[model samples]
Target: MIIFPFGKAPAVILVAALLAGGWLLLHPRGKEDANLVLWSFAKTHITAYNQALPALNHAYPDVKLSVKQIHFEALNRRLLSSFWSDLPSQPDLVEIEISCVGTYFKGPKEQIGFEDLKPRLVESGMYNRIVRNRLATWSNRGGIYGIPNDVHPVMLAYRRDIADSLGICVDSLYTWDRFIEAGRRFTVEGERYMIELNEQNVGSLECFLFQRGGGYFDSLGNVIFDNPVAVATMEWFVPLVTGKGRIGADLGSGQNAAVLFYKALEEGYYLFFICPDWRSSFIQEYSPRLAGKMALMPMPAFYPGGRRTSTQGGTMMAITKACKDKDKAWKTALFLYTNPEGRSRSFKKTNIIPPFRDAWTEPVFHEPNAFWSGQKLGEMYIGLADSIPPQYSNPFVVLAKGKLSQALVSCTQYYSVNGSSGFRDHIRKALTASADEVRKYQKRGLIE
Candidate 1:
């Protein structure tokens, strides 16, 4: 087994050598001549793409597409293993989640198996029509490797049934300071909490940090997890998820997390949670019982006029360089991404807004959603779509995710043990050290 190592550059080099030499797969696949295979990590994406096949075939009737769903981790491993090999099982196009996309850009430009689509975007006149910031996550070392599929603008959703009692209008939100005050008043002892914020999970912290214009990396691909905005975000957020007076609750993580959510949601254990455009599907799918009882709104800004939206989860589609029919693959991708009819169907199913501006005018996007208590969910998402901040991605971001997550836990733990007395000072030093660790890894990894 060519071990899938992470950390050291020497190990990365060894794995790259093993992959390039085609040692991972004994019977590597050649291109599938009969059909174009499209692999996706999410079942929802596969379903969404499958719905677009009719439109794709209508435009290019000769193109045959096979949409397949792969387990997230397995899909990533297979993507890496088959990227350098002439693997027959390799799909002509693949949908990679934002979190795993950076791992594929770990090596030299030649090693990046996805073809740059920047020229194609310009040629197709999509360069200006699409939300341009959404493209940053898919670019690395000046090469645009993927096409963005969604504008995952994050918002806040609360149980209106509970908030109504307190005369709190979830829609008429203003700032985080007021949000904190509301949480204090809204939270009840063991029965219900203000929101789902876990000490172990830094996902919510990242959302608020992004709202404050902070991220693991800057637009120039510089690591900036130690920036003042990050420090301030941690200082404000840590107290909410930690300490005896914590208003947030840890519902757990992973598959079991959903079960916890269903139960907690049924019991009204948490009043509010971060809701991105894509997350509404999970909400509807997992807890349909709560329909008509929920209210969705823009996430309250850190300040009065700060951005009301921050992007969370995302995915991008890329055409593999090894594919024999790059033109057919790109055509199929473009149709699925920009076709108004196909995108409308997919949006209703998943609530993920397309990055394409051309598809935004579809009437379904403006209709009131019954699931969100007659709220014009799509209209709200579109309104905030332009405001969704761009999230930068790089090979080092994978490491930064873990490092900063640990930094969050450390900062909160320090607050828990010693109280908030020098917590800000401690957070600065701690986050800086964490940022430096990612920098060191990047410095050495570049040596490869």
Candidate 2:
């Protein structure tokens, strides 16, 4: 036989190589990759995430996450459809607006409760730092569903120079009567009015209802907008739209009335408007000339001595049951909300105020905004934080709020075109119709 001495040596080496390959195929790789998807309609959040993700990856070297961005409304529809279709495409984490939480939670496949993630969050001091009764509340029946990342409340934004020129002390313009008087003084016969209120602005209705100690729905789950308080509030608003506070061309013609309102403020056609903290950036970017001339005051108090605030917009983050790595997701969310450096970066980059109570006390919030006359914009937000009410946690509220918005639009049309005859009666009919529609939705379990 023609055999070589190295033949056996070559066979042994081949066998050893095969064994090592098999071992590696079966053993762990030391790094666990997590597929994380995120959804947001807000452009600012997208920018914040781009900066936050790298820091998160560095903190957890062994884990990897990927984020996907989508518009808020589209994501809501897509998620609902996916669940209904029983599809496997689901995200590990979702960023939902506070108003839409009920729509998601009432569905058949509710996400993992916050109680499940409490241990990790508590250890990180996020739980203690969050304001208890604000948007971040643990449900009484079982689990926590939301971690508040940002908060925005409606406030009176006015032309400081105009108010001063009119000899109207802004501090004295707190009560409803005083506010009306100020608007009258600032309003000229045919030119600009004292203020602008429209059915298009939902915050006006919210503020009106809040001032009257009324809500769209009662605790018993009955629609209560047909009540005397609601009627009076609507009546108070009607004159502003019809004559006293003539609706501007931009108000009736835009997708974002607030943007138009801000434009009007710049053109000196509007002396006062209600806006949120995000408007500060808009003023900086759009109207540099009007910079340092705007001032943010608390929402007008209902009575002379009543509270001067109403809740507006904010976003929340939640972990889904579909999340393969809940522990890591919770860690990421906690760090985003509580870590001082992370929060400061978010504020500086995105202007998104952290919902953590302790974060409010940080100096970053108190820093002066050059656009607002070097005023400490953070102080204005702190004032809002003090007066925020208990978590308005009813999914029905969203539906009811939507229907009520339509009712306001309809009532405004009636008053504007046909004159205000039996206005409350017509509104009552609309409210009943809205309640019935919501009841149908409730039966279908779209809202609870």
Candidate 3:
């Protein structure tokens, strides 16, 4: 009886000890089930997320992920409000504009470190895949805060028939002077005007200033608007919009200008209009009849062979520190940005330009668009993308630009109403005041 009891006792004790050790190893301390919530403001980006999620889930099945959609404007406000509340439940992932990213970076300390995801991104080739310089600027800082998902650069959309009639080769119309001259020649009385310029349509002005080696702010964050180049650009723009040298109309708003532009195109009003890549899609949707008559080209340079581009609108994707599942979230963000099929789907479905450089040459962009005489719409967009420079306007810079524009408008109105003796003096004083305001933002470290 003694021998039998010893054998059974030893065996039972060994089995129990092994089981306890296994349990301890398998269960991590303070570890919870993986789940993530992604808040996206981009309506079209949802398609990209849907296509990318299955693959991500395949790699990480244990993680449950969900998306909450919000409008872009609403999302921006929500981010601002969240800063004040210091809430821990903010979105684990967000889509924000590059111009406003500085705000988030300057905000709460809860933002996840970019170093946390750098290894995976570099391994996945997403880090080195960006082709456009302009897009690169968005995430080129020491630690990448966001990934460029798409880009929309300003371009010149022209009526091929009218351009051909005027003996102007669209490709040759590369400089601002030539572009204006071409507009003047194409403008006919009781017919289409040459171009449309307005307060809201300031892309051309911004692009011109950029090309002439003049920027809104200097490297030291000083407002520098009274330069000779700026003066020249403004002088040129004032006449063009006021109907002095070209067949132009006073466009009070961008939407109003867009309507008149389309109407003019339908009636053969003007030969060219400044448009974005999204505009082509809009034209196809709203005025299908104008298809085959329209074509897009890069923005004209201020001088021959100068850089000719400006960013219009696009969205950026960033990971939040609040995410419980950092690895899974990084994988999802990489898949959406780098997958060829995923990028193509975004372009095909939403017309969003892929941030990946190689994708620009994909068949999706090169495919002849039926709306533009079967021309390769991708070529036009790619050209504009290539033409984009490193110059970017921060949120503060954008606000200052609006203020400066208003000052210019006010001066013009004063001249029109009061018959001011010295237009140059009035412009100088108004610009000086605007510059001082811009300098304040620079002092606050809002602009670069």
RMSD of each: 9.3, 10.5, 14.0
* C-alpha lDDT (0 to 100) for residue 142 of candidate 2: 41
Q: List the candidates' TM-scores in order.
A: 0.89, 0.81, 0.79
Q: Whole-model lDDT, candidate 2?
A: 0.67
Per-residue lDDT over 1-448 for candidate 1, one digit per residue giving the tens place of the 0 to 100 score: 5554574788878868998778647777777555788889888777778777777778898998988888999999898888767576788899988988888888788888788998998898888888877888788877788899988998888898888977986645688778888788778768788888878777888888888888999876679989888888888888898776688887778779879887798789988888998888789889899999998878888888888989998888999988889999999888878877877888888888888887788898999888889998988899998887778888877789899988988998899998799999999998999999999988888814
Residue 326's lDDT within candidate 3 is: 70
Instruction: State the weakest 10-residue window (summed lDDT) of model 3.
Output: 106-115
Task: Give stretches of model 3 more than 4 Å off.
Answer: 1-34, 59-63, 105-125, 135-143, 189-191, 200-204, 211-215, 218-229, 254-261, 393-395, 414-426, 441-448
Model 2, residue 245: what's the lDDT? Answer: 52
Native-vs-model 1 lDDT? 0.85
Q: Candidate 2's residue-wise lDDT over 1-448, tens digit each?
A: 7565779889789889999999999994876465666666667777767677777788766546566678778888887676566566777667777667656545432432222445555686666766664533323224466687766655777788877777878788788777876676567755675665655656667766754567665543456766777777877776666643543222654678657766777877877776666655666677778877878788778787677766666677777666777877777767556767777876766555666776687899999887777788777877676565544545576877888888778778887866667777877776677667877777776432
lDDT of each: 0.85, 0.67, 0.65
Please give the lDDT score at residue 313 for candidate 2: 65
As a whole number from 0 to 100, the lDDT of residue 73 in candidate 1 is 94
Kindly report which residue pairs in candidate 2 clash with one another. Answer: 187-194, 292-373
Q: What is the Cα root-mean-square deviation between model 1 and the actual structure?
A: 9.3
lDDT for 214 (candidate 3):
71
